[model samples]
Target: MATRKAIVVGSGAAGLTAGWRLAQAGWQVELLGPEAQVGGLLAPQPVAGWPCDLGAHRLHAPALQVPAVAELAQRIPLEKRRRRGLVLVGGRSFNYPLRLTDLAQGLGLRGGGELLGSLVHARLSGRHWERQRAPEPQSDIGFGEFVRSRSGEAAYRAFYRPYADKVWGLDPAELSQSCAKQRVSSSAPWQLLWRPQRGEFLHPRGGFGAWMDGLAQLATQSGARVTLCQLSLQHGDLANLDADAVVHTGHLSAALTPDQQLAAQLDHRGLFLLWLVVADGQPGPVDTWYTPEAQFWFGRVSEVGNFLGHPHGRGRVLCVEIPQGRHAADRDFTGDLGELRRQLAQAKILSREAEVSEVVQRFLPAVYPLFRRGWLPRWRLALRHACASGRLWPAGRQGLWLHCNLDHAMASAEDAVRHVASGGASTQWPELAERWSEVRVRD
Candidate 1:
């Protein structure tokens, strides 16, 4: 039998995983990516003498259970770290994965009473339960409706609404219920307070990029070839590549026919990262600070040193993530560091006296998928069109337009390889693609 050939596009966690798995399965693999190094967003860059990830990233405990991820752990040294973060709202700091006592403290006696009252009202009314038992015909509720139904108006207004708006740059009502179902782990107030804490996560010794590099090394050792180049392939171009199977982990538009691309109208939310060195800054116990307030320019700020347990003598390196919408102009990229500092100080995450020694700006073109209302059918159709060739299989966050964890990406890659091994049928891929859509995004 002739050796099977596979071409994996995009070098993020998913593409690299696919390349490695295909090579391991005795298939000839060629992994193509724009950057010389693998790990798209997972890749780390040198900032202030420390390797800082593009954004705040970590391997959650659940992700470690994936076979591919587990195997990578054996190759790379991973450190177990507890998740510690704060959500700044209404000039108060509340523990993330919020605790009841902390919520009460943050909301105050009367506000806390109101919140509980609202939850009781929601339960007593039974509207949410009724909806769950017999959902509407469309069954595609809005994000605001989903949260309000389960947690009541108070929780939605106080917590979910602002954060959703800040992250996706869409009105909660315009966003799909799928966004809430996937992004939000728990919506019930009691569940939010009483859920067993699973704060432990894994981090590679060198960083997330190192893990990708490790996977790439394993793939290369297994005879897979890697190329550093960007490719734009149309529907007719699939025949040109001398590979039996092509795994696309890039934007959906990249693989779609021009006609399909024009009709899809699918888009992604970009992220602006402002890396700063705070001189003489004392590292806080909190690894990340999430700001939902619209007044603040950034959505989340993370201390890079805390991730690796590296104590810096001069200062701490902070990565501030600012969401950029599609309509945002180029000038919007120029973030105001002074205003950011003022907001941080106001939020009590930073000292007013702290001085920023250096600042660097990095922008990621696509970080989160804009899961607008009525996006499911459109995205599904787009994906279906992209994979109609049977040889092309869409995988990963960008390819599937899924807002998911790194582990999900690896698992998706595994699925693609399995499909290819099972005769690479186009008919079988839609079901697998549907399953990929159900993957939830982990914080």
Candidate 2:
């Protein structure tokens, strides 16, 4: 149906970026996605009067500074703002990211000693911290085990495990080290041991969907064709697609046939976002907070209206994040606010009583890709070989079979464009392989 074109298979951050890059490089690109909305996991869903994001969709400082990501964010109007964060530990609340003063004075002597000792242990394990060639089979070990060995059990249990568990919906032992390498700072020894200055998250003036749609418009306007509801992989339609190269940037399983090993690594999880619209005009303290305590049904909670500017000075919008398990199917936050309210009240975190406005749940089959041990070497090799073969190239979180933030996904597009510009030459696949092989947790 098209000549000398590139096809990208997902509409999320990865697919959109790949399409835009190739289109800008003078290739006619067709972007395919199942959802009508372009931004995949990055897109926002409406809750009450505000946007409730299931993923940590905010652009952190280090990620925001990336030129490509910054360029994308600038497409929409955004405000530079900061919100207070708190961590509830030992029945007390302390400033999150562990401010120096809070750690020194707030945590008291014993907690401070343990935290300092943990930092020291991390520094001592030079191999573990730097992510160097592991003395132990690095890939086979789970993230929790690795952290415990290097950073001490307290740090892993008190801080890393709970926070990561809330986001990934799996125990640290189940997730691979590669899945989280990019998110954490250096594990290097002899480094100044303190929490780095926390980065801020972005909130679009209107909603996250508006920002995603803006990018989608750019891709389509640049001779990039987009199709929705075409979820067949039988290759029957392959005869209809006449393209020099194809960028399979959608979900790995959806874009590629299920016979591939890369597709086999997909990790599915359930997400429940409970939005509480308080009539008293009071919201939660922090923009976002993670809960690992089993007593609480929700893992993390955030206040949207406060995070996004309170333009109208209206009521507050609170979003609670919960992972899906067997009990998730029948869980009702609307009727379960009694538990949430009780927690907040017990902690003295909220003065006024909060009420539930709406509840939203999404069960994602492959929300994240876990780069387990014995997995990356082969998967990476296959993708490299596939790209060289010219018919298949990975895109997005699942496509690449790596864990990447929004910025990294966009960076992937830049790499895809470089490959497309080569015009399907055999030399191009080697070059593409080199580029993909270089992909790390960060850009």
Candidate 3:
């Protein structure tokens, strides 16, 4: 008997996980993607004689609990450390999660007193941000409202609003608050008095690329054929394809056929990355540093050498992330290496006389799902069409238009593989949609 065949689109973690799972289940699997490297966000890019990931990437601890992830953990052991992140707001440094006491300290005595008073007003009388839910998925309020209600106007102004503006490119008053739920964790006010606890984070021994390579090998060894640099089928490419199922881990915007009018309704996001090769001892020990100050164009910088314990042999490397809107202007990409060096010197992350090597500039397109008010119906309409087609199964961050972290992406692949195995003949679109929607995620 001929083996059941499956074609998995986009060889990122989700697609590779799907390919491995299907192949293990006795199906002949084929994986395809546009890029030669396979990890997606976690995929490490070589720099200055060592590996530097797309940005900062670590196996979020919450994701280690997933069966597939747990299994992968055993295959490839990684170092676990307390995640240490820093944030600079209003010329003051604080913990990345904004611990209550630290936030109070950052605000001077008078400002802190005002913040406390406002908090009392917000919690005792104002609408509880968490309790107040949007009537419909598409009708959710902006992230600013929730932040103001939760932390009061003073706190919101001090940190959240500026951070949102710098990172998301959307005014806090415009984008959906659901984005906050994914990124920020809400703790009890009482917990503010207590010191924030150190939590575990993971990284591979060599680099993120080693971890991705392990995952890719697992799929291939299980009998899945992976084709690098193979783009997902456009109209003409679909003609010769024959498979029991097709799993897409690429952009939904690209998946839309010429006739899908709702395609324009959904807009994804883009990104700019400035990776610098600096002297080994220049940057500090922080894994991630975020700034809400307007003077700095980059929002977050992660020290790759510190995170993975593997520097490029001579000096350390840093990856700075500047999240851009899907429609960011062309001029945004025009800065030169000298400008970047100047910015680093200005920020004091590096010295003016520090030995700096090549500056790699990257522009990533259609990488994130950008949601606006009343976007659900249009997004779901596009998803519904993709689902009803009976041939396509969308998985991963871009595929589902969710900002899923490393672990959630793998779990999504699991969900997609299971849905596809149920057979396309009698599949229900709502059920598939619900499964993807329900998976709990960390940003």
Candidate 4:
């Protein structure tokens, strides 16, 4: 009997996983990506004469939900990188997943005292005391109001407000509850004041994206044919072929159309990355630094040497991530690093002797979905429109438009398999599908 043919588009984690799964399940699958190398943004490109990634990327909290990814990681050269994370506030550092004491410390003696008082006041007011506070008896509010009501205006102004504005590229008030819950959370201030712990951190031996080629090999060995190419639908990236089914693993907005064009265009945020190679040594208290302060344009910085143990032929690499674009039309994708060298020197993260060996600026347009205020309604609407397309199954962060880890991306592909087997009518692949038009959709 002839094999059941399938075509997988975009060779990112999601695409590779989907293609591999479909092939293992007795389907003839072909995987294609925009680059000769797999891994869209996640691919670990060589920077500063060693194997480094776009920024400090890691696989946190393994997805037991997807056995394939979990199994693959175990079999692969994934080393456990146990580095601490800290918050840089007003030039002071504090532990992350933030404990009450740390929060107080980050706020400093004066601001800390006020935050503690506010927490006490909110606690006494009995607003968030209930496990479930019935209903607001009012219309839905936004992230700003949610934080204020749960904690107090003081905490919101001190932390939540600035943090939200800095990291999300939008004011808390302008962000919807759904986006907030998806990103931060809507819990009351007192409840969230305590520390939040993160899961294990994993990185590949060579680099995070290094595993893509291996995955392609594994899938091929398992009977799937993996091909590499610069592909897109409109420009005929895949113009030569037709198959029984097409598994879209790139940006869903590319395949999802006319009806959702507005939402698709408006919902995603472009990502800007700046990678600097430090000759001296590791900097900062942790492997990753999260600063929401106005002074630091980049929200987070990750030291690669701390994770991979300072590879040969290069100095320690520091990857700084600016949450949004500086200007609307900045033309630097991977350009000069001299401009930001002063900022790094001032912060002391980079030493006076440390020379900026190389700078790689990657501007990924629409890499993240803007989980903005009231974005839930339009997101659901858009997903519904895309899912109704039937043949095209969108998977992964870019495809699903959700903020997720590598595990979620792999699991999303697992879900996509169920949809492929059922010819897109499966209850799984698209998130809001099963609950479509139900109370959940409206919610």
Candidate 5:
């Protein structure tokens, strides 16, 4: 056999796994990325001598059972975090999923009616959406429309619109429902009404980045080389970088040269997160809180200091997340920690004297692909055709143009191994494809 090798670009979970799998399968692999670190968006922060994750950190329990993720988990310490999400709306507190009893009690009869209407709409619409075996929408429709149609006007205003607007920085009407379906947890009126107890949240012992760091070590030791400070793809040049095969994992925008076809296929998302280290405070939940009322500048706020351990360690570290479109650095702390503190005070979630110790801002671009309905078939067709060529292959969120979580990225890596071993890629691997399709999304 010719000394087989492969080049994997981007050091995120997807890139790392692809590189690792191929290398483990006896093909030399070279992994490249744009930053000094290996974990793509899953990077970590240091708060008062402890690790804090700024990006998606926790893993659902179901993810651990996967062989690929399990291997990675074995090398690192996985710890479970508790759930305690709260919503501060209309000067009242609703549990994470929005409890029916709480909503009824807090909002009185009128609020309860609105909540009930949303529930009925969601149940009816959700069934309609799932039953449709025909083609989905052609052009993108806002999540607001879908929610209102399926769940009711009040539901859209109280839950869907506010949540979408805060996260994506666009009217729910402008944003694609594909993103909403992929990212947010499904909530029928009944699900919200019941307020079920979800499973435990998981993260690395030190930092989420630590998990990647450990995975990278395994990949490198298995004969895969990870390189940073390199960008752009030049056909045969990528494969020639001391490897036999190549996996392109960067955002498609970052990979492809200017082309109209490439541009249209590549819709993207931007992200802005502000990290705050505060005195004598913590996130007080598993890892997240969503702001549907838009009282704060951030769509979501996370107390990573608590999940990563080091709770009450002199200071608290919180990450305030804003979708990239509306997040301007010059803007007045758009829903960031400062604003969050202000709102917390108003909601009585925090005391008047509470102050932020430090604030840091981070911006990310093209983190998500804007895939509209009916686009998936065409996308799958194109991807199938492209990968069939055996040279240019899709990898990562942009390359695949789909939503994925960290474990899914690693699973992609494992799939690459199977492809290399079998001498090609195929949809025949139904089980593998289904597994890949279940990846989580962290914003």
Candidate 6:
């Protein structure tokens, strides 16, 4: 009857959740993170008196029912709000979770007709059924093919193609079908034809970081140790830690051997979060704006005030996500401010006369996993190598390379803890890992 010791790596939501759960289960837990604070992307920092996240992050309504997520909700007050956003396409503003009427009106006669015709043609030609009956392995089918099969060429080119290119900095043809399957919610053209309705989402009273801090506090209260220190498997750094189980919630590369790392060829897309304080700015009711066009350097822009339900005031902060492709040389992003402002004005997100009071730039490496074609096999191989010792458990978005939401990370943490509780059975984890692989990324 000895107390079990668990080491949880990468103090993000998954690591913190695993630490909390293990501690509550009467196990000794040590949660470690490279950053001083927890929450990873969910961490919020103050920008011009307004709390802004690294990016626009929110807990979808579906995650509320999760036991761990529900526990966090109890500790921190979560406000349920209807999702509001716009997608700017071809110089037209379309309500996000886009509506058919809006598209028809925005595209006008010729464009709308082509779009409608394409959809009809796709259906009549049974392209959707053909896609279902595609003989090629899922890995062989590219993102471009998957989208075109379901939504037709018009929709693919109009939105999916350009947006995927802008966000991931990869040709849609180079991206895996799994990427489309996980990230694109509406696979069928008919799905977009439905009447547009706002969806509900959850957010903490202060910011998402509050929830992470709360989880860490709860974990500590339950007798878990939290540390702000870096750990590396490549250098054999984790070899000395005396733990019955190690839950790794960082990038898979971090846990791999140097040779395995080279073989895996794993890569990530970095982000430049340009936080701007606009004086006398009116963001309207929109929470986020998606800009797929190449003219806009930033892919997505979010109004922090809208998330917290704060009214238009003297100033508001906007977080703009600019994807810095896989191997871009690091340089000063401030130089791009003028172009950003001009584009923001052009998009009508900001008034031309509005003065940008202050601008802060934060560069986050590895914001997203680059899901290149045939990446699954490599990812699985890396995961297997990382967990070969049977002591390490990879969990969370980064750990699993899953483009999932915060709730999914917490749920994965729960599953990891369950596996550890079962005496780290070798047979149990592969099934769990397979299940994790199938988790669809929610936008």
RMSD of 2: 4.0
* lDDT tens digits, residue span 64-91, model 5: 8667688888889688767667677676
Supply candidate 2's per-residue lDDT for 214: 84
**TM-score of predicted model 1?**
0.93
Candidate 4 similarity to native, TM-score: 0.85
Candidate 3 lDDT over 179-278, as tens digits, reads: 6555552443423556456566788887767887898999999999988864656633532458877777777655666666355466656778878787
As a TM-score, model 2 comes out at 0.82
Clashing pairs in 1: none
Give stretches of model 2 more than 4 Å off: 1-3, 64-67, 125-128, 133-140, 163-174, 185-196, 199-201, 230-240, 261-263, 283-285, 292-294, 325-335, 344-352, 381-389, 424-443
Report the CA-based lDDT of candidate 3 relative to the real structure. Answer: 0.70
* Pairs clashing within candidate 6: none
Model 4 ranges with Cα > 4 A deviation: 122-140, 186-200, 235-241, 263-266, 280-285, 329-339, 422-443
Model 3 TM-score? 0.90
> Between 5 and 6, whose lDDT is larger?
6
In model 6, state the lDDT of residue 267.
Answer: 82
How high is the lDDT of residue 388 in model 1? Answer: 78
- List the lowest-lDDT window of 10 residues for candidate 4: 434-443
Q: Per-residue lDDT for 189-238 in model 6, tens only?
A: 55667744658677887788877899899999999999987543442655
Give Cα-based local distance difference scores for all models: 0.78, 0.60, 0.70, 0.65, 0.64, 0.79
Please give the distance, in angstroms, between residue 428's alpha carbon in candidate 4 and its true position after superposition: 7.8
| Pairs in steric clash, model 4 | 44-209, 150-189, 175-373, 176-373, 333-361, 334-361
lDDT, candidate 2, 163-224, per-residue tens:
56665657677766654454443422123345465555566666667778887887887778
What is candidate 1's lDDT per residue for 13-84, written digit by digit as tens?
998888988998999899888786788888878787777888888877778788999998999978987788
Residue 45 miss distance in model 1 (angstroms) = 2.0
Instruction: Report the error of model 3 at residue 13, Å.
Output: 0.6
